[model samples]
Target: MLIRILFFLAFLFLIDWYSFQAFKASFPGNFWVKLAFWSFSIIVYLFVAYTFLTFSNRGVSSPNFGRMASLLILSIIPKLIILTFLFGEDILRVSTGAFQSIAGSREGDFLPDRRKFLNQTALALAAIPFVGILHGVLIGKYRYRVIRHTLEFDDLPEEFDGFTITQISDIHSGSFDDRKKLEYGVDLINQQGSDVILFTGDLVNNRSEEMEPWIETFKKLHAPLGKYSILGNHDYGDYMSWPSQEAKAANLQHLFQIQEELGFKLLRNESVQIQKGNSSIDLIGVENWGKGFAQYGDLAKAAANLTKESFKILMSHDPSHFDEEVKSFAHHIHLTLSGHTHGMQFGIEIPGFIKWSPASLRYPKWAGLYEELGRYLHVNRGFGFLAFPGRVGIWPEITVLELRRK
Candidate 1:
């Protein structure tokens, strides 16, 4: 691990050195600009290394690390964009030098002179993402958008034709730095006036206590029917270190209690009935199940008594579960609610014209609604940010799903 980290840092240092050349090329005479540039660059790199080296043992739990991680991300991304232009120009310069050698011409230098205009252009282009990364860290993560999706199904219970379910997933409370912003998100969920609220999981990042400070804030969310929740991979305390097996078990049990305090019925491989008038539908929930992550969910167990005829809505934290099992399950789960992807915390999503996220490469059903084999899945983008501590075009989502009988 230490060797890998050192190699990674060395790569970053190379980029830092290369990008600084662009600064020099653009501002040849401004000594102050160069001084300030190196000063900020060195400080950021040192802080990143210091945080990793000093806090690796107690890192995830520290509030300071989250800020440091975000700062590192903001710095690295723009620098990478700058690296792209600089690297591309260098490639062209090499090709030109090779061509001059073949033609037997003596040049001032083996490679052509680096153009000031290109360097200036690179800096200008880099500023776009520099500002974007800065904004994403500051405002985009908190900029919540309510996505309304109406799903029509032939087998939907008539009583549930207009049943509205507001779903939020991946709270990652450990990453939250602002209470007011989260409270505002909670308020937005309540304002939707949905019949019931379903949180598909990831109530906290790595530990249950992370959700303690915001328990009261989230308790404010209300639904006419009730609020239902299921566990995500992070809720199991797998990402952080624990003293003993018993302590890890206790941490999970504490998370169950925390969910109860917030008026959520945490379902673990279980099913409950949501009754309306003379009709009812199965609301089944399973533990976190993914291809690479924990496979704690048992679909057969969760749908033990139910059959394919039942009008069912399932909650599984990871969308990978849908493609792997749920879509072809004998019980035929009609709709699956999930949020583990978080759209990779970055992407370009423009609805119809373009909807692309790095997460899609991993999760086929990364965000919004997807249908296959006559079964449906709605992958909530996420209610909160994760490791990156910010969102790009794929902003945090509050999914409002209205079930309709067709």
Candidate 2:
């Protein structure tokens, strides 16, 4: 771990050095101007190092420190972009020299100095991502988009036709910095007026205490039928080191209690029957089940009393569960809701045009809707940001799924 940290810092320094070179070439000025630029660069470097060390000493549990670290790291993105252009120019210069030498033509020098236009152009281009990332951190992270999808299912219960279900996931409460912004998101969820509200998982980052400040805000959310939730990988406190097993168990119990306080029925490998008139549908929820993460969910146990004829909606945190277990189960799960990916909190999505994110490389069903074997899975982009403390193209999401009988 220590070696990895050292390597990371060294890499960051190299990028910073190249970025400084670009700055020097692009803006050659008086001593004061040079001092100012160098000072700013040095401060950023020192701050990043200090923040990481402080967070590491604190066991890296505090979300504020994590956010600070993220912001620091993000500040370097523009510099890296600038360096890319600078390095590309250098490669072109070298190639030109090689070709000229092969032709027996003597040049003024083996390699030319950095081009001013190229450096300036790189600086200009770097501003795009720099401003974009700033905007993402300031405004995009709280931009709650309500994505609605009406899914038609032949096996759906007639009574549940047009049943509206609002789903949100990956609410990393520990990372929230603004209460008013969070309240607005909760209000938006309430505004949907769906029949049921379903939270896929990740109520908190790692501990139950993180949700204490936002409990009342979430409790305001309402649904006519009910509100249901299942644990995500983060809610289990698996990422942190607990002093004792009993303490860890207690933390989980408190999290469950917090869920109840917020009017969410915490479903741990269990199923509930929702009734309407003479008809009923099964809402089965399992614990955090992912391919590479924790696997505490029992699909069979959750569907114990239900049969193949049951019209079921399964709530599992990770979308991978659908591929790994749910779809191949004996009973047909009509719809599965998940939200562990958060669309990577960055991506491009143009309706009817394109939807792409780096997260797709890992989780094939990263966001939006997917269907296989006539079964559907809806992956919510997530309600809150994590790790990065901000979002880019993929804004926070509030998903409303309407079930229809075909």
* Best candidate (score: lDDT): 1
lDDT of each: 0.88, 0.87
Q: Model 1 over residues 306-365: C-alpha lDDT tens digits? A: 866899999999999998999889987889999999998788877679999889888878
Highest TM-score model number: 1
Report the CA-based lDDT of candidate 2 relative to the real structure: 0.87
Error of 1 at 132 (Å): 1.2
Worst 10 residues of 2 by lDDT: 55-64
Backbone atom clashes (below 3 Å) for every candidate: 0, 0
Q: Which stretches of candidate 1 lie over 4 Å from their true place?
A: 1-7, 56-62, 98-110
Q: CA lDDT of 330 in candidate 2?
A: 92
